[model samples]
Target: MAFELPPPLAELRTRVRAFVDDAVIPAEKAILEEDREKKRDTLNALRERTRAEGLFVPHLPKEHGGLGLGIMGMCALFREMGRSPVGAACFNCDAPDQGNMDLLLKAAAPAVRERWLAPLARGEITSGFAMTEPAPGAGADPSNLKTRATKVDGGWLIDGHKWYTTGGGDASFLIVMARTSDDPRTGATMFVVDRQADGVEHVRDVPVMSPPILQHREAELRFNSVRIGDDAVLGGVGEGFRLAQARLVPARLTHCMRWLGWADRALHMCREYVLTRESFGKTLAHHQMIQKKIADAVSGIHAGNLMTIHCASMLEQGLDKEARPYSSMAKNHVARLLCQILDDAIQMHGSLGYSEDMPFSLWYRFARSARIADGPDEVHDVVVARDFLRGALTTLV
Candidate 1:
């Protein structure tokens, strides 16, 4: 199936690209070293401006004060938002909030929607997804989950330790995955735990190799008898893994889309540099070596974008199960390409690209994490291999 954006979505994409280039990218320069509170304030101000421009929450339903764009539309728009490190946040569409919003919209009950999803969609608060845990617990395999949710008289008591919980420090709440039964296939359940709850403790932000603004601020969470009502269970008792997979597939592809934009921008910077910079009595652009890097980067980016849109189309057509293999392939392929493109750009610029004077260094550091986040390359490789063995190789064809 053709994945071309319709005329309206094409227009929206252009508008978002212009806004990101003119507003978001310029604002990002000022907030690179801003304090946490100041960062929040600056992003909030940008969100207001984005709303005024009628581009806020463009992926959510129109009933939720968004533009009601589907997955295909999001694929196009998110790439523009990725042009700036903070572009997605400025438009109220950054993760883990963006992924959380998608989950709540599909899984939350009416009351839960009113209490949590409404504010999230409006960008009134931030949220986190807590699934990964320390060793001896769940990491790549959810079946090994160690977090427990024991039923009590009133509701449930959740006790566990989760590391790499993205945005946990500043989130108003977290969607926590806890084991509630003995069945490995259906033991885990998702609970909505408030950040201010008595038993919820934030240990520290795990250090990562990424730009300060782009770093996910991975939090170590300790849930000690965190009490919550029956209302907190999301998508019912045994659907944690199922629901998480739903969130992850799209989340992975969106990451690809945004990183694609960042890589594209880096390539553009490299092209400009090569054309203007002289080397050995000739412009760098005239060098065959430099031209090869540019050509490869462009070709890789085109392939990555195609894979991203193909995955988006699968999700849009309600084929999440069928899309898993493609999702893994795209995530692994595009994430690697993102790093390679940034590396090429840095190499072409020599010392300047490696320095803080340019954004290539920052983009390189951030793109490195894309390979590990939302499932690492190794895991995705296993997924692709397994799918091939099962004869679900149509996606590859």
Candidate 2:
């Protein structure tokens, strides 16, 4: 299919690209510290500017104070925002929160929407999705979830140890998944636990190679007898896995959209470096090895972009139920491509690419997690393969 954005969306993409280049990119150098408060302040300021510029929360519905762009529109705009690592946050479309907002909008009760969704859409507060847990608990397998929510007098009492909860430290609230019954398939439920709720402890942020922004900071959390009102349930009881799957499918696609933009940026930087940096008395661009890397990176990104657009279009048509296999394929393919593209970009730039002076290194670190985040490549690969083997695969073309 020939993919073309509507004129308005195309214009929005251009504006977002300009904003990232002019504002977000420049701020990266100024805010290079691990200080959580400083990072939050800088990003919050940019988010306000983004809101003033009419580009905040592009993925949300218009009634919720966002552009209400559909999935395809988001694909067009998110790529532009992905150019800067901080781009998504500035627009209030960064993950955990972005995915969290989508979940709340779909499943939250009327009162819950008034209190949480409104502020979240307005970029007033961020959120975390607490699904993945430490070992001996849920990791890639949700059936192993060790967290439990027992019925109590006025609420559910939750007890669990979760790690790798993205944005846990700064999150205003968390959408926590816990088991409520013995049936593995229909036993889990999702709860909206306040960050400051009793027994909801924020353990130390887990160290990783990536930057320490609120969005990327994975944290360990301990929910020891935390109590939340029955109204805190996100959807119906025993529906955590179903709701989480619904949220994650689109969330994974958005990650691909943003990462594609970052990969494109890396390629652009590599091209510029090759044009001017000479080796053996000739520009590196003239060398076959360098040319090969450039060509491969460009082609890989193009393929990934098409896959992302296809998946986005599928989602726009409300084909999410049928698009699962395609989503998995796109997510796995694009994530691996992103890592390869950045690695090649670094190779072309030599020591400069490896150094923190350039954005490539930082992007490289961030992209490394893409392979494991959301759902790992191995799991997605199996999803695709299993569907194909069962003759259940739909035509992605």
- Write model 2 residue lDDT over 1-397, tens digit each, in one string: 6677778888888899999998998887555553445446677788889999989998888898898888888889999998877789889899989999988898988887788998888888878889899888999888999999999998899999999999887889999999999797889999998899889998888999886754778989999999899899989899998998889999989999998898898888888889999899999999999999888888989988888888778788888877788889989988998999998888888898889877778778877999999889899999999988887776545
Model 1 misplaced stretches (Cα beyond 4 Å): 35-38, 395-397
Q: What is the C-alpha lDDT of each candidate?
A: 0.87, 0.87
Sliding window of 10 residues with minimal summed lDDT for model 2: 30-39
What is the Å distance of residue 92 in model 1 from its true position? 0.7
Please provide, for model 1 over 1-397, each residue's C-alpha lDDT reduced to its tens digit, 9 standing for 90 to 100: 7766688888888899998888888888665656344456667787888899899998889888899988888889999899777888888888899999888888886777788988888888888889999999988777889999999987999999999988898889999999999897889999888889999999988888873453277889999989998988899999998998989999998998888888888888888889999999999999999989999999999998998888888898898899999999999988998899888888998999889898888878867878877887999999999998998856544
Instruction: Report RMSD for candidate 2.
Output: 1.5
Question: In model 2, which residue pairs have backbone atoms overlapping below 3 Å?
Answer: none
